[model samples]
Target: MRRKLAAGNWKMNGLVDDLSEIKALTEAHPDPDVDMLICAPATLIAQMAWARGTHALQIGGQTCHAERSGAHTGDISAPMLRDAGASHVLVGHSERRTDHGETDADVAGQAAAAHAAGLVAVICIGETLDQRESGHALTVITDQLRGSLPPGATAANTVIAYEPVWAIGTGKVPTTEQIGEVHGTLRATLRDLMKQAEGVRLLYGGSVKGSNAGEIFAVADVDGALVGGASLKAADFSPIVSALENA
Candidate 1:
């Protein structure tokens, strides 16, 4: 069975002062049954790791450069994130794809870099509102999986997150059925592509919160969530963790 993961992407948010929220989260679930992680902004990754102390709370980077080290100005590399105590790094988040125009091959490169640095690569794939409405959501996401996954990815070092573009931060969530269909398709796609597919965790993102987490977690093949806005606070995020544990 795949271990459930409740991962948060602080996404261009949080500072040194914000470390307390993670601290509180560790305190709330000192011995959580499921894994807990926060992918903070680059500036706060090291500090958050320090704040987590001896707790099981994991710290990660929102994104990392495809290259281990390069002349690329303003880019953080995977090795750097690992050096700062991050055990994982997000690759190909929708915002990054939209804002930076990252292609699937670019994401594959980044994932490879993360693997080289001994960090888990949470590879994100999703569809826009138009694609879903046009009945191409599954095709789009599957294509992304085929194109974005690195050459050497395995269940232990890779995770997949599906976040519908329209649902993120929009207070809109895909119905449980919609989530199930996507996750099911993703699982099949992984099975066809990798020998370790069944052990890989599949997480649903986009407007995930405590109120909806239980139902979402109930879906088949949904190992957990890649929470966004709701993850910034302990009161909001703890319940989601609880829901996953009970799920």
Candidate 2:
């Protein structure tokens, strides 16, 4: 059976004072059936880890370095994230791709590093609005899927997210039919690439919230979501998590 995941990308948000929201989440939803995770800022990993309990509230890193230990002044390595209590690390988020100028090879190397350090690599891929408008969204995303994912990316150590660049934080979402189409393509690609290995869960992102998650998850090949803004608050995020339980 495929497990449904409800992951929260807190982005650069959250502070020491915001741990209360996590506390509420862990308390309100003890033992969430849906695979639950929160990718917080690097600075808060340790604190969140300390508070983590059997609720299965797994914590992940927003990003990690491709190099284990290098002169990259501002880079945090996968091992470092592991040491800081992260079980997973997000790679190739559009923000990183745009702001840091990361390429497919860079993301692949980062996923390799994450695997080397025993962490699940959450690989993100998406296309801009212009690409979608020009009817090139699938081509762009497929190209990224072909280039960014590395060898040895199995279901156990990796997850893929399709976050449309135009939809993220913009309160827009691809129609249900559109999501199914892309996800189905992604599934076929992954199956062929992996030579028929199963358990690789494909997640949809881009402005996912409680209101729209059920419909999104209903789409073929969509096993989960990588939620953005709504994740900042437990009230908004908890329902999305619950949505997965009955999805």
Candidate 3:
């Protein structure tokens, strides 16, 4: 069975003082039933890992370069993230796609690099409001799943997060039925495309918070969530972690 995961993306946020949040989170959920992870900015990764030492909480990086080492000035490579005590990394997030013009091939390459560095790649794929309105959400997501995932991707080295672009940080969310449809479709697509699809975890993102986490977790095929704003604090994120544990 796939283990549930509660992942938080601090996303260009968090400072050295914010390491206290990780401590508070670990104190609140010392022995959580589901996996817990916090992906912070590269600057905080090593410190978060050090702060969460001996705790069940995992630390990760927000993104990584496709190459191991190169001339990319500000880009952190997968191996560098792994060395910084990160066991996982986020790839293909909408922000990167929109802000940096990252393509599916680029995402796939990054995932491959993460795998090479023994880091689990949290690959994200989602459709925009226009695509959803035009009835192309499924097609867009399927194409992304096909193109963004590398050949060697497995349950061990990869996880998928579905985050609708319009809903991210917008307090908008897809209906429960819509979420179920998309997750079910993703599961089927994975089953058809990979040998170990059953063990691959599917996480729902976009406007996920403690208030609505339980309901979202109740949806079929939703293993957990990739939270944004709510995850910045232990008080806000602890309840969502508890909800997933109960689910």
Q: What CA root-mean-square deviation does each model show from the true structure?
A: 0.6, 1.0, 0.6
Over 4 Å off, model 1: none
TM-scores for all candidates: the values are: 0.99, 0.98, 0.99
lDDT scores in order: 0.95, 0.90, 0.95
Task: For candidate 2, give the lDDT of residue 209.
Answer: 85
lDDT value, residue 165 of candidate 2: 96
Error of 3 at 232 (Å): 0.5
Of candidates 2 and 1, the better by lDDT: 1
lDDT value, residue 125 of candidate 3: 97
Q: Model 3 segments beyond 4 Å from truth? A: none
Pairs that clash in candidate 3: none
User: Model 2: C-alpha RMSD to truth?
Assistant: 1.0
Candidate 2: where is the Cα deviation over 4 Å?
Answer: none
For each predicted model, how many residue pairs clash, with residues at least 3 apart or on different chains? 0, 0, 0
Worst lDDT run of 10 residues, candidate 2, spans 190-199
Better of 2 and 3 by TM-score: 3
